[model samples]
Target: MKIKDFPHAGETPPFGAGGSGVGLYIHIPFCKQACHYCDFHFSTSLKKKNELVDALCQEMILRKDEIPGPLQTIYFGGGTPSLLEAEELAQIFKTIDSHFEVNPDAEITLEANPDDLTEAKLKMLAASRINRLSIGVQSFFEEDLKLMNRAHNAIEAVTCLELAKNYFDNISIDLIYGMPDMSDARWQENLDKTLALDIPHISSYALTVEPNTALQKFIEKGVVKPVDDAVAQGHFEILIERMQQAGFENYEFSNFGKPGYYSQNNTAYWTGKSYLGIGPSAHSYDGETRSWNVNSNPKYIKAIQSGELPIERETLSVTDKYNEYVMTGLRTIWGISLIKIEESFGLKFKEYALQQAQKHIEEHLLFLDQDRIVVTQKGKFLSDGLASDLFLINLS
Candidate 1:
């Protein structure tokens, strides 16, 4: 199932209407090479790297008052943030410091590819105050890597993890299951490497071929075999069982972590906390309105240089907010809080949610627990579908 296919799920507001504890997301839209499955905005060529960086800093300065005091998390996600030199990272951080009040213990994460995490780079990262690393080790097998057109090979994947663990204890690695050629054994081997690495957190997703992506074309032309939904479901079940056995909490649909190791940045998003997303194609939400920067690099840089925000805005309706609450809340271990629904969206919305969830509860897909609607183990793999099924269609 497509993760982004949830009906009625869009720009969701935070827990309370005016909630303020904020997170900062910096989108570095440059990758060394494009992955077949990736649809996120990015550029393969870094011809305007300096100008883009300057634009990012300017955006931060321009939008400093978007969110209130004490930024709780700072996430650097993108084509490959690890590609940036240490000095560049520091320059961006310096800009953020000048404009925002970053908590001393805030979670600062950099999304890095396996090949870029060299020994010297790790040391520089450790010194740069980036306390966490989210490595894109999509698979531990060479075959899978080649199929996805990843920049790093299987050997580099393993080697980098070994090196990264020494410098940073708070690390998360991403792995993909449900590839066209992935067998049960290969899926197990990927998990085996993950567990062997003693990594505290893991985020895994089923391989989805988005429209216009290479994988989609390959399947259309019969160049590559199509992914099996049943097989993907099986892989997910295996992942849940294995992670539970290893003492990791399935905090969110695709994330498993050892208690405190949960991704604070992502959790903020799932829990509906306000955040300021900077750079190209980045999204930002403050309680009532959600906005996004221009997706094109040249347009975004030009707009920023011209002293315009280069963003689009959407003011969420009350119905829209409640629908979002149902969508994001059900995807996490925290589930949907009935009290929150009643308090934030009103009793009518809460009653509507309960009425809609009745069928799923009877089907054993979802259950009520101390006022929270939670997905049962049997329904975890189908959470997105189930959530959409429970969404309120009326916005009035």
Candidate 2:
């Protein structure tokens, strides 16, 4: 059936005819090795890598104009996209530029492992149009790296940042807090090292053990201790305070950045900008509809080769739209804009949200800016629960 026959969700105003623009996410599902805690789609075998890259290019060409807005941002996220040689990555970007009307100033970000980056590699990336690099520097401690089974050691993680600064001004690094063994002093050391770097963006994630990962299995077998809530909470406090002291803004729950160094593509996604996703396990949204490619390498390749897109989509319901806005909005530093919230969900929602805010405000977990309802530091931990309380439950 045509998208118009789906529902009246996007038919409402502020959400546009189908809503705000789109962003393209390309997943390069190849990795030299897997981290014990990761559950993302990736394989360690290099046998099919060359073919996979070709398939990815073909996938991009196959859905060149699938979404709208000409494509403002293109993100190369992955198991470790930096594992590929610069020429290979360039070939894929070339395909995108040829087919998608990518803006001249579009943010082209590549996710890389610290081990994969070097001065030579950085120079090659700089020569290409790739403007940003999001490095996987999970921890700056050797013991933590060992526990996480990360590919790079503590020394390599630090060195990569030094090398990366020579090539890219817009750089983002991922740091994982809340490890069972990561002490406050150790955590402080990691934060100090990260702040010393000249990079702009930082994505500090709380470690979560998802189902079926090796970490979970190890804990199940009693080979490792599970995460400690008290320890995690302590480290979280350290992260917030330390980053704030370093002059970084907590732009999102897991993201912090120096002034103007925010990830344009990711910010667009959170603020409801649209983008196409290509390759295996990639997700795409055209504002009204949400779609994602198949997670299997062979299956994704086969579908693209056979002139079919390996994807499934869902038309957004009014309820889905409201819940989505609530989910994404409440996690940012900007918080929920009461004015926009009213315009988008209606006066009833704004009232209920304010009512919910009152309880948090009394606890000092929330506050009101001139026009926005911003969550305080204490509220960030229970953000999901708080957001759920404000959700438009009966907005069918």
Best by lDDT: 1
Global CA lDDT of candidate 1, please?
0.87
Clashes of each: 1, 6
lDDT of 1 by residue, 341-378 (tens): 89998888888888988999899888776577887788
Decoy 2 TM-score against native:
0.91
lDDT digits (tens) for residues 1-396 of candidate 2 = 222221211222222112234577889898888898999999888788888888888887877767666666778898888887877977887887788776666777899999889888888888987889999998988889999999999889989999988888999999898887788999898888888886688888888898999999988998878888778778888888888788787767788878777777767766677778888989887668888889999898888778888888999876677778778877776677777778887887778778878888778676666556666777887777878877776753
Candidate 1: residue pairs that collide: 14-272
Q: Cα RMSD (Å) per model?
A: 5.0, 7.1
Q: In model 2, which runs have C-alpha deviations exceeding 4 angstroms? A: 1-21
Query: How does each model score on TM-score?
Result: 0.94, 0.91
